[model samples]
Target: MDFVSELAVARYEKIGEIVGKCVEKIEKPRTFSDVIDTVVTDKYVGIPIFLSLMWAVFQFGYSISVPFSDAIDVFFAWCAGIASRIENPYLASFLSDGFFGGWGFVLVFLPPIAFVFIALTILEQTGYLPRAAFVVDRAMTRVGLQGKSFIPMLLGFGCNVPAIMATRTIDDEADRKITIMVNPLMSCSARLPVYVLFAGAFFKESAGAVITLMYVLGIILAAVMATLFRKFIFGGSPSPLLMELPPYEVPTIKSALMSSWLRIQIFLKKAATILFIGAVIMWFLATHPWDATNGGELIENSYASMIGHAVEPIISPLGLDWTAGVALVGGFLAKEIVIGTLAMIYGVGEEGVADVITQHFTPASALALMTITLIYVPCLATLGVVRQELGSWKWTGLVLAYELILAYIVALIVYAVASVVML
Candidate 1:
């Protein structure tokens, strides 16, 4: 019995040694070629993982924006109150309502925008986003674009101007032009407020889903538009998508924070400069003809009111009233200014514009308006860049005309469909 027990112990020890060796081999560091081999062999899991990462990114944008946005609102309200107590009402109004409100609107969105850029930068640094482009390459090729064009499109989600500028990376001039044209359709962060506010107010249960759908719709529209342009207008063969995936590394928290801070700074500077001017202009329009009888409230009989009334007829078919028309016009300067314009026009304050819009506009109208905003002409900054890069106003004019036509057509379709279904 003693000899048999010793023999069993010896056999068990040998088996344990073999298992340890197998585990060490499995845990060995993967070589570059080894990783590529694995990726090629297991694309199913790799593709899903890529998608899951994107979903997490969108989730991060929504989650991080909430607290930061609230803080910005509080800060702006305090500033506005302090400014209102100043001696000169016009100067105070210009500082608080026009400048602060306009700039504040853009500033409040920084957290989410920064988070998105950081996440994307991390993905870029870690080499996964290129892989994403690789996975989507076939689909992009079908639409007459190289997978590399997606890099700028992804960047456009943070801001469209830089994304347009980034198109310089594309080798083919025709491909680059097409890329610049479709980058706006990727639903940049500037448009996020519209999507989030409306989705929250009207489709609370499906807010995330609805927002996701809008993003997908934007991408689909871009792909279709690119395909059509290539087939008829551009007249070029699809470019080959070629990229090398870099090895993954642990993303530094410090680097990520710095990236976020820089982005926030850029956004703030834009708010302070371009958006400040826009907001003041909007305020001048919305607030004038001092109403002494109405407790000094800025009356609608001011200069801005006259312009709103003038443009109302043209935009009313899209379900936008004169007030909405003003907002649309303001949006031409910077897409984000629409919310601020509405806030100022409705006297709802910057944070309250979404709520006021929800209260006044039906879901159908709101959706239609959102669609129009999505497909409307590029902002001044974008158009300037387009003109500079394309080297002529001809393409810029074409883009504007095409987008306006598309916006009107799409807005009408959405309105018609919603009216029939909802009724």
Candidate 2:
């Protein structure tokens, strides 16, 4: 063996001997963690176990959260009914249809999102999240990413802004950049509302499996893109996976609640500020160009329609009309807004959004839009963090340019394939 290789082997032997000397078993011969880890961290079973766990998470998450979502929907409907009874038409429309209708659509998603965060927090606090990283580290290594990069990628499932920021923990510049570049493919919870809306509308029986497929597709795409980037954009060998795994423990209720609350707070804050502003602006655009004859037909005569029509031709191949085009434009600001924009455009409010969507979109088109949504450039907030982390607008622009092109290509491919099978 080479001199450096021999030294590394000697150091590992020394460390193992030291650990063996210091540690001893107490009462239980082999602890509970040891038995669980044998199966969970097994090279063969680990990945499949992780996937099965994720499927169950989504299934339980959506199934249990539906009643709470419906409760929020009923509350909004009551508010809309009260506003509709108001004497003044203009004020009533603005309050009921514009303000409540717009923002409430995003708010109703809180149940499922909270459930996801709670589950993720429990996994994280129990220390299984790191094992998940370890389980996938080998797969990541094959794509030229250090196993350390897996943490940031995992964080991306919650939100990409912090995920990109989390890239700072990665020591290698190329590895960090690649991780940041692909983090958006992790499918943040904000996108879940869109998936649920459409999945419920079209694929009612298999909504959980469909959503799981999208998550899986995101992972597959991230790996493929990482491979391409490593082969062409940047060439580097991955660092070896070397990290201590924590023993599993029953997570404290307080710790799990705190973690979940922190994530939910971010969502609530965005809903109040950024999402509220975007909704108001969209409402105005869909209501303006004041005239008497076409006063009530909000979207058809408004400025938003103009913009949507202009972009319609570009996205028409995916079976998107002007309304869908406009929603896509707003989705650039925040993915959660995509469903809200659609709801607003249809004048259906939150409760009737799925029905309206079905009237407008074919199964193929809906699938295509969902695919695009999954792969598109992350919301504007993520771009700012990307620029800050990369320290260059050049890289930020490259990230945007490539994601757009890639999204379009992937969406078209989905449309083509789905069309063939359905036909």
Query: Could you tell me every candidate's TM-score relative to the true structure?
Result: 0.85, 0.92
For all candidates in order, the CA lDDT equals 0.77, 0.87
What's the residue-level lDDT of 289 in candidate 1?
59
Residue pairs clashing in model 2 are: none
Give me the candidate number with maximum lDDT: 2
Give the per-residue lDDT digits (tens) of candidate 2, residues 67-102. Answer: 999999999878987897788777777778778876
Query: What's the residue-level lDDT of 209 in candidate 2?
Result: 89
Instruction: Write down the worst ten-residue block by lDDT for model 2.
Output: 290-299
Error of 2 at 327 (Å): 0.3
How far residue 53's Cα lies from its native spot in candidate 2, in Å, is 0.7
The CA lDDT at 350 in model 2 is: 90
Best by TM-score: 2
Question: Ten consecutive residues with minimal summed lDDT in candidate 1?
Answer: 290-299
